[model samples]
Target: MAETEPNPLLRYLVSDPDAFAHNLAKAFEQAGKAAAAYLKPRETGDTDFGSTDEITRITKTLAHVGEWWLADPARTIEAQKRLVGGWMDLMSSTLKRLSGEPFEPTIRPDPKDKRFQDSEWNDNAFFDFVKQFYLLTSRWAGDMVEEAGDLDSHTRAKADFYVRQILAALSPSNFLMTNPELLRETLTSSGENLVRGMKMFAEDIAAGGGDLKIRQSDYSKFRIGENLAMTPGKVIWQNDVCQIIQYAPTTETVRRRPLLIVPPWINKFYILDLNPEKSFIRWAVSQGLTVFVISWVNPDQRQAEKSFEHYMKEGILTAVEVVEKSTGERGVDTIGYCVGGTLLGVTLAWCAATGDDRIKSATLFTTQVDFTHAGELKVFVDEEQISSLENQMSLRGFLEGRSMSTAFNLLRSNDLIWPYFINNYLKGKEPFPFDLLYWNSDSTRMPAANHSYYLRNCYLENNLTRGRLELGGVKLDLGKVTVPIYNLAAREDHIAPALSVFEGSRYFGGPVQYVLAGSGHIAGVINPVGKPKYQYWTGGPPQGSFTDWLAAASETPGSWWPHWHAWLTDLAPEMVPARQPGGGVLEPIEDAPGSYVRAKA
Candidate 1:
């Protein structure tokens, strides 16, 4: 018999004992630093790393599922048998493959699931078995939650979300020995990858001030006013809550009515003006519209007492006044994105109630006034969870920006969290500079009062569309706002589900042209006309269920910006000479993208 070749992994491990030992020691040292950083005392306002509230909540949710399943002996037996049967079939397939026979996998991951994308996961029998095993167990766990008939809708949703999170955390792809690519890298590099990765891990912990501030992009490469929010404009006015940015018109002539944009304070407004190429602000200005955006302040303890009413009064209401003053336009066309859109709706209602008709036409992007169909975000808005969050906020005077950032990341863990985790901590690579990811990492804090009111009134009670919401001693009635409305909902928005937005269109007492854009919340709204990568759908009035409306809607391939522009022009057809930023009554306070946006959380 021919002598068997030595295993490359073992050969490499022992080939240079001294070098390998040195690298191993260095890796251990870096890992110790990382451990030390993680165990260090947290700063003031920092969240407790070992907080048991969430763990207890998850445990109770899982227990509810277990109780339902175990209540009946038949159900328990059926669950066990199904799981065992899957494992048995998987084992049989592995055995056949080992015996030099071709065999099909017992189960496969969802095609969209990128976690098992490595070719070796299928070609190698061991990894193949591991992938199938995890898929089978995860699918079984999901089925168990779905089949639990007694769990309430909220509990069931919580259980499903938590279980998926737990499964994602335990994926074999996350570990070195289990992940084929990681194992290959370890052997080929003699564990040098781990040394570099551990060093980065420790540095990141320190950067986060005892929290894991995973770097999504090379943040150093991007700056707010220079590379990121470089739109030519002037900060004409500002109050405590926000600064209003009036963009200089690119066109020789502009619309009679200026446009005021209300972006969500959850993030910076530069998402609209990421760069000249992708900027909605630039595009709108070039389309002969005077554009003004409210750049919300990155609030701290000083703004902690600011409430939802304060945001409406000092933020949107003040911006409207400034835009009218600057452009000398009595009425303005207003656009709102996400939570900002929700606030816009409330403002419209309040304006109507107070007989203030400054807003002529209203456009909402991926905004949810009706939270009945609000997606997974509702999972984090229960009374218990909100109370816990409030307690944390009370101690800090504001919710830590990372806390919200982590929740948003968890919503799409595989895409957002895990990819970076693997690349940064496993492959030991720095992420490429991406403007969107950089903007994503630039988070903003939520003032305690403002955040609490938003949670309880919007997500928790669904009061905005129900005519139950009150602000500034005025009962807000969406039905009273009779402005021509353009409601745009993204087809795949997790933050504000299309169905939720669709349901909201009916609450407004006005003609609503409901359009559904392809892609998610960010991509759908930020789609520039020049690129036209996605499509938008249009139909008659938003009537009946979102599904029926979608079926009858006509699909147009390209950006929704032009379509929106056409609608906007039709509403206010008169043209006037272009208005320069701060060219009117309101003098320039500062440059565009404002100092408020520059103040980091």
Candidate 2:
């Protein structure tokens, strides 16, 4: 039997078990040294003040060790050899369907499916063994204070502080140093990295560590267009994230009615309206779809008081009112992605719960209505992380785009985060200026109140889907939304697990279409036509269950955008004849894709 295709996330995770283990061990080792060196007794009041050379040596040593382990020549070859075999296994797994292997679900089937979560629970059980391996080493946690404890804190308070740091880092859950057989070897090469990280953090006040290189001046190029005027295109309308100017097309030119786009605040909105050529908004316009994108205000320390509720009011709702009033259109088709999709879902529910169904149809791209099985992120979304983020946002008015970007990057350390570090910091090479990275680095801040509320409610509490999340003083029951729904999810996305996203199909009633796209989190949405990229598959208009649908779904090549365009063309209000700027649906004074150009980070 032919093997089944490998899940990207799993492939990524198990890419090189040996190398992964090796890197982790090295990281640990470097971290250990970094910790020791950083915590080494500094002569109190002796103005040498810990020479920069000392601190930098520790950081470089840690980074060097981590990089070495991550890209170890022998390790890489071994990992590659292992992955080749794994790929064959993966291919064999994929071919099984053709060879008539009964079935193996892409995601663990819900217990409701009358089935176990996995066809192969044994492997998961093994991983569970690996994870739980720590508990087996109870002596490790209670083991003598290993590295930093050796430091002469020279005072009780200092010693206590050092002890507290050790306790915080060595919790049973974070006890990565346990099981000397498994991880310590890897740490041997990389342990100093961790310690160095701590010291750098400790000395940040003096070092201006605030220089988190979130935005690269030359990293990404934000290209401005010559056609500054908001013009009707294959799309209906467009808004700016930078909110540089407020210019909706003029009324006389309003023949092309507005279709407003709402993107998740978690990311810069330009992803949808990326650029003229690859721009989805532009594509929509070319198809004679009137598009107006909501360019969210990138908050700063000044905007910390803003709440999620305030955003909806000033964000989508406000945009709707402004567009409708300008174009004299009674309703608008609202499209959203990720957080935007969630927001869109909540907003739609609010409208329905309140009996305000002004929206035509709702399209959710890679958005999850349910948060169960949020995947690897569930580990990091701990209460403390949320609180730390909330406090940060409290002072900054929102979590800086860089902080959020860093968190997401960590999810795919080998791919997103480490590769760049290796390329730039390790090899002493400049990273090629890529627009996506630029956009990514150009992150926007969420208001403090809203960011905190979102993390606690959506991630930590998982309340939004559990029927507990209330927005704008309204209980956001997704079941309340009656609008025809279009949902897209990426099969390989670790960020929003497919199973979690499939839960959307159940929440939103009405004719629902869920399409599994070919790319990862961001690439899926950026899917352009003719990329000959990943194939998409769909189940049924009358979908049975997520599993049933997945099984019955047929595959389609290239991006889902074309299919969406076709589907949307069917749903789209017939295109009004082309009109001059501000002639029909547009108001001349407002902007096109406003508020998108600011330095997000």
Candidate 3:
């Protein structure tokens, strides 16, 4: 009989016995390191790995979901039937494929789901079945949460968010055995991949202080003021809370009114000055606008007592004062991004109440004044969670940056979390160098009093929109902010939903031009004029519902920067000889992208 060739599929079962043994031994050593890293924090009295409060909250919320399903037998039966029916169809399809008969998949992942992009997921019967089964179950679970009519909106939102996370974690693509690509890598490398992966896993845990800070990008590949925040500028003012950097003039003539940017303390301000190509700050400067950005300090125990009121006073108001002193302009144009935008709104209201009109025009970027439709982030902001977080913060005097970073990552776990997990730990590969992810990983700590006040007043009570919020002993009324306002919202923003932003526009007392941009929170705002990857929409006013406003809006191609500049010019069109940093009044403290932004969390 002729010799039979071995099956290609079975090749993974065979390996060089000595090489396999060697890799296995090395992998064990790495595993020991990982174990030690995990326990190091516990040895230091930081044993709250799986938070009891979070566990209890999740259990109670899931129980509420269970109660709703159990309350009606018909609903329960319907859900089981839906899942079972999906499985039966998937099984049928698999059987047909095995018999060499043409058959369609019982279900398909969303087009945007990158996890199932591997061809083997569709070509291989086993993986196809695994993918289909997982999708079926996940869909059934989501349906149950959505149909739980008795549950309150918050509970429903929490359940939905949690279910999605669970499903994302449980995806077949996350497992080496179930993921064809990982299995192939493991087989071809004779398990050497696992050894390398385990070593990296240990190193990452140690780097995170036993908290497992997954490296989203090669941190060593980038550095602030060198390649990342490389925009030319000088730190002209400094306070305990922040360092205000005034960028050097890019043009011979610049806008008469200086531009002060109030970025959120949740992250560093360098996001706006990421690079020459993508930097919104650099682009704004090139557009002949004198730009000053607040680089918020990474708060520690010493700064724990700083409140939201302190940020308003020492951060925004102080930056405004310094800008006025430096530029010799009493009135200036201001732009705020994310939570900073929220603070700007409050400042505008406070200014309105106090009869201060230094903020000539206000531009808000993906900022939320109303929490009613605030997206998935609200899941982490309920009374129970906030109280638990406050308790934890009280012990440390500040909330760890990783906690917030983790929460934000969880909001898009499929895209952000699981991909890195599979790549770094299963494939033994380093994440590609990405400036945005680098900035994202570089997070900032939140002051205890400041974070607590924000959660309670904004997310918990929805105080700002209600005109019930007070700061500096003055009540803020959004309706009284009569400054000509330009409100920009990202259509797909998870942090600040377009609907929520639109609702906020109605509260402003001035003429508001509500613009809807493409993409999510970060990419939406940092869109550069040189490279136009997304489009934006412009409507008369943010009237009626967001859906209606979008329907009647005019679509414009490319970045929203030029449109914003045009609006700024319309507000204050005068151009003057460009002023250097410090304006010969406030002495330059240091080069731009100063020490404050470089401080690690």
Candidate 4:
């Protein structure tokens, strides 16, 4: 057994336990002081927990809950009936299976659900019983919540989320005893797997965080710019905020209108250029389009003042200038993804308002200009949470990647968090070498000012969609963006839900072409023409509601990438001889996926 490197944060604390205890004590003290202040009277009177009004309030709450159940007697009765019926069905199914008689399951797991994909679960009576029991239990919990109709919506949602967490925590897959496969493995391995699992658990805890990075199986396989981001290109322009990369041409003739990609600063740019097989940039270049991507700087304390405006001027606008200079072309086709799309939308509106027509056509990939329904991520954007985040960011001058990653992983705990816990810690099995998972673990820090401003303005207030968002001393109006716009959304995206992404189609004052890709946030955008896994949908025009559009749309058999290229090429200028990399006045500064991207906060 080899010892791995300890986390820097925990290494110091582990070496000096007394210092760690002191720090922990100080934290508790501060917490106590804050709690005391909150509970204490303004005039310095001693705090009293058992007041008449407080007791009366508690009694009233209990009375209200009782009244709610009593008043909805029929609903409660119906809920009980459903639960009984479910149990009966489960029992009947189990008996039939035990008797070797064919029985149809009352509740079947979704075909697309990967969790219960094992054929053994369906083939074996015991595994099927476990799965059925789990499903029934989950349904009963949901029903319990539904029966409590008297609770406020917020309280109900919180309860539901917590219940999901509880259920996920208690999943049979997490334990060797309940999980038949793991139990078999334990017996087969002579408990060596369990021993290895224990070692892994201790190693994870000592590292300060239990969240694993690279899979144990792929510990030494992948590296940036080697197995990943292997595209041939050069950084034609670099600034304090970002580096602009001009990808080398693959085709003899290129479209005069170059494509400029602005990926979210929340992650690296290599997501679109991961490998030769899946690189969207390589595909675009192969399509006879000169492509360029913006590699955002991983900001630190010194770059704390970098605001939304700083991203526009130094990030998007700078890239535009560099692209134009390199190709000797006035207009460039722009693609903004996620946060980058949000930034690009603001820049386009700013450009339209200021009469600066740099962008020929706009393409937004899973980008949300309107954050009114920004999905589950919105839960952590309230004033209280924002204030707490601001306090932490103020201390460090930037939000750490780990904090951000935790929040994101919470969005899909069953898929992202618990499975890893089972695989890495409980089962002690190494994770498969997944390229996307590697990219997902690779995160970046957000500057205090920029992040706070974004959370408050875009998420909390949703000012961007309302035409109230002011950037660079200019109020942005998304409707002013009249260029041919294409909006791409993922059907199964959690971060930027497809419907939320669809809303952008209505904001653009142009010929809007909205395409719904298959898969979630990353896989949807990265879906190639070759992948037979998923399909896409494209509707008539952005005329009615998203649901209506979805209903009216035609399903495409493969990737939406080709469809996007067709729409872009239709709006683009005539083709010309390929432009040499770094052929313009702005000379090449470094290589593509530049030094800024490799920097950790």
Candidate 5:
């Protein structure tokens, strides 16, 4: 409308002339007050800190009016001059009246009270208070400076004026205002949002103070002993950064055999193998299947040479060898969660590249293979951001865990960083403790090579989906490997959107069962028990591709684990007798869940 030269007032408010006049009159009055305040200037001078002694006493002595020359008559003399310049910039900018005057309080200060009205025409105590306060403050500053140590402040002008300007900006009689709606959401009742808010605020203060500290804790209800595997029931191998445990056989285990879990390095693997009853690892173990899980070594700065390819070569592939060597099996069924699944996909690519076909079947949980759909994370993975990250990785040799966590938190401010910041930083309170919060704070590091390559190729370039991505110099052709693939996508995952997970299905060229699980990323993958209210969606081998399957399948709500179990069992080898093959001795460690307990610092 403005571009069209159509008067905005004529279009939206031509019919309300009376309202226009009244509002316009009020606006002019406020403008006049603001302009008056803005034009009021002040002088500037010394600060509370004393002048330099080296440039001071001699300078004052040099300023004698009686001595403009030296004893030689052709003497040299120097004069000192210091110049300063700045402009005033604060004032009330609410509204103005047609008379170019501020609104005078014609009404009582409060209708509910009787003693607050003024009796004269220029009776605005607000502006009067401002003028009076500025005068007194300026005088008091000068009067009090001599009592202070070797310094001068009252000698400075505009010092008190700057403070007054700030206070004026916040006055109800002034312009700036607060957002009511945003403030309300954080302070409402019927939920702990209020409590959560206070803690976040506290954390901000603690963080700002540069003393922010994070310590891990043990939250896992499940535990195992040094003789846990030898106990004839269940077993767990605990490490400084991970806990590995095997479960008892279930009815479903009879159909499924040699189930091994591969979890991501970003966090502990126990998320998938949460507990005996709900643990997917335990569920597989109990179902008459031999289960083994790989626990990743947490690398600090010293061990930063590990890369994504290295993880595949030494981590997953080695775990497969260990599992096979112990069971005397040529291959074992596998399940990968999140980046674990990402690593699994890369491993398959590596296998195909090397003509090594050892993996029989694979399942991916909330794992993304095609990076194009990584959503908001895209903002932080452009070429520039990647370059910045590369420089950062160059500095640290890898991306630190806290750095990744900070990036993840920023993706969803309300859900992660802000809610607590408002309560803790703004409101000044302590952070309330929660299991999820505790887990979220427990972070792990990534190898610099892995971090840089993953960010550049997968995220910035979206190379995996574009068919432009290569792993360890080998074209990662997900379609070349002909192994059965199962994918469980969380219905409401922010990190790994379900549809994005489904995109990887097109890269695989075998029987693919894409299941949409009914939870967020980790919870959905870790789901075991047939929860009553869960839901899922499934596609088929005949659906052509992931694209075709989505077009054909209908949505259903319930635990999709049953269908997954059936699908995995159909592809897995039948169970064999209990036997131990050529395996390393059970290295006796300290206690059940030792390292993780330490993590619970």
Candidate 6:
């Protein structure tokens, strides 16, 4: 056989003199077609710019830009003045430092910011200079961004925020060459760290699309039933969507009304049962409350067709039935976290509408039923993003856990994303096996139908609060729910803002004890009474706004768990002798942290 050349396109390009000219003509022809297609609708007086919010935002941005253009002379003068003052201050500080005089940075790092814990910044003058200069540059850029009146709009502000984040992430200070400590380590290790970092990068690229944040060995340090979710309990009931874990009683007698906890399906239920020390389940059991938690299954294409109604029926309603049957009681106190709380609210509304009295009282943890002021998370749950996500899920039938995690991480990129990037890639070191980080890295997939319905009905359309959202054939109305409510909002929660969480109180007709916790979402909820790290505030229900409520609220110096437990105990029935796990229609299927939670997506 005769030898034949490969890559016909390459041969055609090189062999034919006219090929280049022909390709250029073809490219221009395609460009023209695309342009005509895009402009044809506009030419015919037809156009859909975007949603009302998007159009308003774009209009405001343009107006602000025009205003800035008109005020350019004054703004330019002000900016120059500020820049010169900043540089002069820097020069003075440098001279004082050279003379061995005491000097401090004007803008010190926030105590919460853990990015600069290394001692080198203080020990070395050169490193101090670089750090100070970087701060000055960042401040100048931030001032410029603020001065740009376009950022007045929330959408534009968020866009500018992320752009700054990308720029900060690409800063030289994060790399080995600019960082003094990394440079020293490279010198001492003879570039071994660099080799190891390269290897780690390659592995991450191959395995996780460069999203690896934990050491493979660290994952082995924890397991579903062994180290994590080790609270003494049994899987009393289970169905296709979720497993109900009934914790073994720790007291001689327990409260008459059993407690049912509905945790977010986005995370494993083990967050409530991480270990004996921090496990909310263990603590609740100790408090003489019969605790039952719903552990959702990590779904695959097999369950992608499952709707939010499916979750309400199979996840919460089924668990309520089993709990009531086992305890021989008609009513149970319900507690929900994040989306779990949102689901719990919907269930309560449904129960009230149908004259079902299974839920006696309700407690919501960092939950938002009203999406009006939903904080930073609202940036991701728009029409364009949801449509794109739907397309991806249509192929796989579920949203991949890792991909979803990336969006959540970006909400607090400096705290969560960059630190991991530096530790795993720049430092070439193994990540310390922190239990919370492990759980965060272990994510669960969202079923295509359920997730799409949730984003559209609850988030996009804001129907749940508007009395338009229906589930399991019941028209949910939060106003119909008359049970006493205990609502907790975390002050620093980026996912569900405290104001958004508090807004749900307006929909309920009953007495509500709204408490503001001190920390972020997960940390605020997981705060144990014994170790009480964050302070909480007790307040009357929503007054005028979150700010007004905060002004009137009284600060309490410890965890909100004690207050909640007390309120729960006061409402619950008289103490009765403890009962064994699994009875009635429900039988013990497995240990507490069942196979469902352990199943990988």
- The alpha-carbon deviation from the true structure for residue 467 of candidate 2, after best TM-score superposition, in angstroms, is 2.3
Cand. 3 TM to true fold: 0.97
lDDT of 5 by residue, 44-110 (tens): 2211112254234333323332143332243222111100000011122112323466643222232
Give the residue spans of candidate 3 off by over 4 A: 1-8
State the weakest 10-residue window (summed lDDT) of model 4. Answer: 8-17
Model 6 agreement with the true structure over 350-414: per-residue lDDT tens digits: 88999988899999999999998887767667677788779878987898887667668878777
Clashing residue pair totals per candidate (backbone < 3 A): 0, 98, 0, 0, 41, 0
User: Candidate 4 residues 1-601, lDDT tens each?
Assistant: 9998764323112344455355445544544543444444433543223235434433454454446656777866766687788889989988987888988886877687666765656766667778878888888876676667669754455456656766887876677666666655555544556555555555544332332342334434678888889888999888889888999998889999888999999999899988888989888989999999999988888878899999999999988888888989889899999999998989999999999997988899999988766777875666666887787788768987767776777788878887777777556677788887777777799989889999999888999888789987888898888998888889999899988888767888878788898899988899876655678998766677888989989998878888888888888659999987777677788777779888864
Ranking by TM-score: 3, 1, 6, 4, 2, 5
Error of 4 at 156 (Å): 4.2
Local distance difference test scores for all models: 0.90, 0.57, 0.90, 0.77, 0.54, 0.78
Q: Model 6, residue 294: displacement in angstroms?
A: 0.7
Model 2 scores worst on lDDT over the 10 consecutive residues at: 113-122
Quote model 5's TM-score: 0.60
Q: Give the per-residue Cα lDDT of candidate 6 at 311.
A: 92
lDDT tens per residue, model 1, 451-492? 999999999998978889988788999998899999999999
RMSD of 3: 1.9
CA-RMSD of model 4: 10.7
Residue pairs clashing, model 6: none
Q: Is candidate 3 or candidate 4 better by TM-score?
A: 3
Q: By TM-score, how accurate is candidate 1?
A: 0.97
Residue-level lDDT of model 3, residues 1-601, one tens digit each, is 9989776577456367678788879988998999999999888877567577777888899899988888899978877799899899989989999999999988999998899998888877888899999999998999889988889988999999888988898999999899998888887788898898999899999988888999999888998999999999999989899999999998999989999999999998888888889999988898899999998999999999999989999999999999999999999899999999989999999999999989999999999988888878898887778888898999989999998999999998988899999999888888999999999999889999999999999989999888799897899998988889899999889999989999989999899999999999998898899998999999898889888889999999999999999999998889999999999998998998899999998
What tens-digit string does per-residue lDDT give for candidate 2 at 1-601? 9999785234213334565566546545654544444444333321223236434433443343334335657755644464455445445544564567854522232245211222232243333333333222322322212222323322222223233333333323232332222233224434333343333333322222223242222342445333222233322233322231223322322224457778777776666655555566656656655566666666677667677677676778877776565556778887888888877887887888788867878888878767776755564455545665565555546665656676676565434544443333222235566667666666666678877877788777878668888776778787777778888888888878777788766877677888888877878777777454677887766256677878888988887887887776677445454443343554454345443444435
Which TM-score value belongs to model 6? 0.82
